[model samples]
Target: MSTLAPPRPSPRTTASAGLRGPARLVVRQHRRAFQLLILLTALTAAGLVAVALWAGHDADVFARTGCRVDTVTTDACTRSTRAYDDSQYRLNHSLSVVALLTAVLSAAYGAFMAGPALARELESGTHRLAWTQSVSPARWLTAKLAVPAALTVACTLVLTTVCTWFSTRGTLHPLYWHDTSVYGTTGVYPFAQALCGLALGTLAGLLLRRAFAAMALAAAAQGIAVHVLQNVRGHLWPVVHGPYALARSNPFPRDAWMTEVGYLTGTGERLPMGTCFPIRGKFGDCLDSLGVTRRYADYHPKSHYWPLQLVESGILLAVAALAVYAAHRLLRRLHA
Candidate 1:
């Protein structure tokens, strides 16, 4: 059990002397998969850049024809915009699909961790080859994690930056910002989510030690975690409460992600606007009749984006750390 815990000097040793063999071993073992990972990253980044440039060119061409994307349709504007509109529609649809794919990337990472990174080695008894060598379990696990973690982090960082830049640059496009897909694809959260998935899946594999079962457990558990996080996301941050002025309220700043809209009482209790249904009187009269002290709009302004992202990333990273610690402890116990 003591040997399961790396020596105090192991960190420096591992960084310099210990890792060279194991890291190369792990990469060689997964050479095809590793190569595929690199190839996909390069292709995806290049393709996204090309698409953005092409879309920008199309938009500029449409603008040259004297049309605006947001304005009411005139005959000439309508005729000219048909091609541009089609292209934009397809692009937005693709964006949504890509976002959905990005959200599930964590699940894929988890599955890979369980199925290949740990379980396959264990099931095939190949891990013993490393453990039987100068490599300790800690170093073996570190080698396994470090390579994939680096690749996953770099992959998400590049994709997120590209997607965010493209999405924000286009004024005619709407912010899908509040959507889980959009949020998943555009920030630090995606990589954090992937890291958490890897850790949790590695832990699961360490526990189960069977390839298929561990893969299923890891994928399902991580997927559910991501879904739950998205569902409870609105509560993660304190929402900005509204101008009691409602319609006349200074109006939410552009791109604010509104979470709730309703009326409030003097006690600050919320009531839906429908609660004041009027048979004949105006909406204002109905509100007055109900003693509605003020209207409420619970929202997250655009400024909250980074704050929310950072907070969520913090949570995911914390969980990842715990999972890795548990994996470390479990591996020690198993090898003891």
Candidate 2:
């Protein structure tokens, strides 16, 4: 008698088989949400690419005309500059809106995770049914957190990368780097903020166990956290201090973030900037008469961009970790 060999699994079957019970359940339950997210992400990506191309073309036109703001005074230079400025403004404004939308989406994600993902199950006693059927509460919670966390991270990375590319290459706009709207979407900040939202939402779900309440709390918490972080971001890194005299003609380095510019007394006391003002007079004479030894500026140079981004990201990530830990502890207590 010929023994039948076991049937070989197809690629689809093999892939499906790899997903465990909790993972499978989580994916199935959130499939619609995932689909929506993917669609939105794809649309955003396409728009960004289009903006990049348009901005790039405008930049090329400006470059080809050899337009220098300080020297070029020809009609071609004037037209090129005007066209480039308009393009830059449009693209930069669009990107800034996208950056703001990222934060809003983060809040929405948090609310959804808190309400539909975890809190609904708890509130409806569905979690208990799952727990009875081979799935532990911890495993269920893990799946809930892990799936969204993974998706959030991937989406954040892609958007951040696109924004960075647009800001650096597509537009010749200076100081776009330090703008609040641009800063949020570039570098590691987006990822950190996204993770913070996910973690906080999970914690809210575990603590409240009421879908609507959890969602509300999570969103409120996210708003507060974002506000605080935005205000404190400039202080996270040491600013480069330069004499105001040298900086008078060209304050701060090219594209640097000027945090403060003020008068400095010979005794090293910092005075308000008004002491040297009334621009009609000779600046040196005005300063000498006012006993202002020099003017100084505290600024973050372009080189410090990465450092500031990383520092802020680190703080956000730490907050996320704490939220995650608190969520786990809350889950354990409820189960006990």
Candidate 3:
């Protein structure tokens, strides 16, 4: 039998060779998108906060002066702490938009950034060249994931922390602001969750070897998982308390979709702005005239918030792990 020769180190064995190019490639491809997204998100959030702070103080002035435009300037010039209700309409609306924007943009960006590194290499046959060289497939994948993942996680955490701080001050009827709509689902926590989705999407891109295709699959996977988990896990394993009811006793104007007034009263009824009127003759006429009559209370279980977040974050991390595993396996199998 012919003697077998010992294996020789591949040309790309040197640390400098395998890493530098891929690192640059990832940054160059994704940098502009990241910058634009961050700029837009921050700017929108800032604008909203500015408007809220201004409006919060102005609201009290308007109330005191019976909304006379002339007194507005005087009131603003001598603004007092009492005038500023931190949990006012502008603040709530701003925070809601910020939350939704952060969630959608983060998810999209994360997937976009991650969708092309290894799969493209595999598609183009360059991965085989690297595999033939001395570069370990696992190491290559690690390098590919580490830099972006770290940067993304750090960035998201920073933004979310700040947003969460502001969010705590918001006082609008939480249910009115947040419902089962898309706007309700996104928030500071959701942004963090989306980062995990991005990591998983990126991992999928590496394994699947196509950007849009992998991204589509990733998005679908995330959407379905989030929906199912939000429903099932929320009902079964709630983090916050449950069966919490909203306290709006009056019907909002037919044209009015949401309200920014009042707190939950005892017995869980929405106490309307107008003084309570007994359901008697003259009182009924007054209710009809001003449209201020009692109705059923609005309610939401507290479990909707924290527990859902915990579950979504866990699922995303799981997806990220699976992506990493698949990337390692596929890259290892590539032969020169």
Best by TM-score: 1
> Can you give the TM-score per candidate against the true fold?
0.88, 0.85, 0.59
TM-score, candidate 1, is 0.88
Give lDDT tens digits, candidate 3, residues 162-240: 5555555444324232343222334434544565566666666665677677777666665665566546543434222
How are the candidates ranked when ordered by lDDT, highest leading? 2, 1, 3
lDDT, candidate 2, 233-329, per-residue tens = 7899998888866335755556788888788878888887776566665877777766776678898887887998999889888998999888888
Worst 10-residue lDDT window for candidate 1 reads: 167-176
Each model's lDDT comes to 0.80, 0.83, 0.54
Q: Which candidate would rank higher by TM-score, 2 or 3? A: 2
Instruction: Tell me the spans in candidate 1 whose CA falls farther than 4 Å from its real position.
Output: 1-15, 69-76, 176-181, 246-250, 277-286
RMSD for each of the candidates = 6.2, 4.5, 10.2
Top candidate when judged by lDDT against the true structure: 2
**lDDT, model 3, position 269:** 46
